[model samples]
Target: MRHIQRIHINVKSFICPNCAKSFKDNDTLQTHIKYIHECERNFCCRECEKTFVSSSDLNRHTQMVHMNLRRFLCSTCGKTFHTSSNAKRHFDEVCGKKEKKNGNS
Candidate 1:
């Protein structure tokens, strides 16, 4: 209820002192401060030694880049992409012609 009131109502109460950016909640503001302002990346990728602000980001990087997991396949072009947005972009932007269907990667 609080989230809906804050986010849906566009009431950004928490303002970042450094950049003057507003956020819906304190946790988001803290996360933005920790990652953007302080540049404190805690989640490290063992595969590439790259660091990220959150564990989800590290997991995404590992799965997409290191694992080569192309799960989002373009229905029209039959091309595989690492993410759903990428596949949707292909379908929207360039996947007009039906390319030879490759089995799911």
Candidate 2:
């Protein structure tokens, strides 16, 4: 007879000391600390000389501003957006039937 052993894998979490924000990985936690707490902008845009906290933000800026790429489009209003979230926001705020309270809408 042979004996079999099982191993358990735990979900590793990294916590921020300042704001108590949690992350799944150490690299993500470090990045959050560097960008949010430390205010480090290592990524720079060559076109407009703007600094960004991450490369993804710089790439988004370049695509939207320099490349003029509007990938997300609103079906109702025929408006275009660079990101999906913005289009969704427009739909919720402008197009959706949800009532506006406190003069916000």
Candidate 3:
């Protein structure tokens, strides 16, 4: 309940000593330290023999690299991209405001 409360309240109690990043829960903080700082790749892809620090990353790599799944498509040019962020970037370059520079619109 305390962990859930921290997330809802946006109170980051656990702070990483190495990078000074904050997490709402201890488990997330520990995972960040293990994966980001320690570079522990627990999940591995057998097909490509590549390792990922997290399972979701391994899944994304398998879908994009091995399966060649480009789910996101740019509406303007009809270009395909593996990630939604890439598609949105292409869309912004094509139709919307130019890609952000120095965090400005």
Error of 1 at 98 (Å): 8.6
Model 2 scores a C-alpha lDDT of 0.80
Lowest lDDT 10-residue stretch of candidate 3? 96-105
lDDT of 1 by residue, 1-105 (tens): 896878689888899999999998899999999879998789999987999988999998999999998999987658999989988888766664333233322
Shift in Å, residue 95, candidate 2 = 2.6
Question: How good is model 2 by TM-score?
Answer: 0.53
Number of clashing pairs per prediction, in order: 0, 0, 0
Candidate 2 or 1, higher lDDT: 1
Off by over 4 Å in 2: 1-31, 98-105
Clashing pairs in 2: none
Return the candidate ranking by lDDT, descending: 1, 3, 2
Candidate 3 per-residue lDDT over residues 46-77, each given as its tens digit:
89789998799999999999999999987655
Best by TM-score: 1
Every candidate's lDDT? 0.85, 0.80, 0.84
Worst 10 residues of 2 by lDDT: 1-10
lDDT of 2 by residue, 30-86 (tens): 988887999978899999999998799999899999999999998867899998999
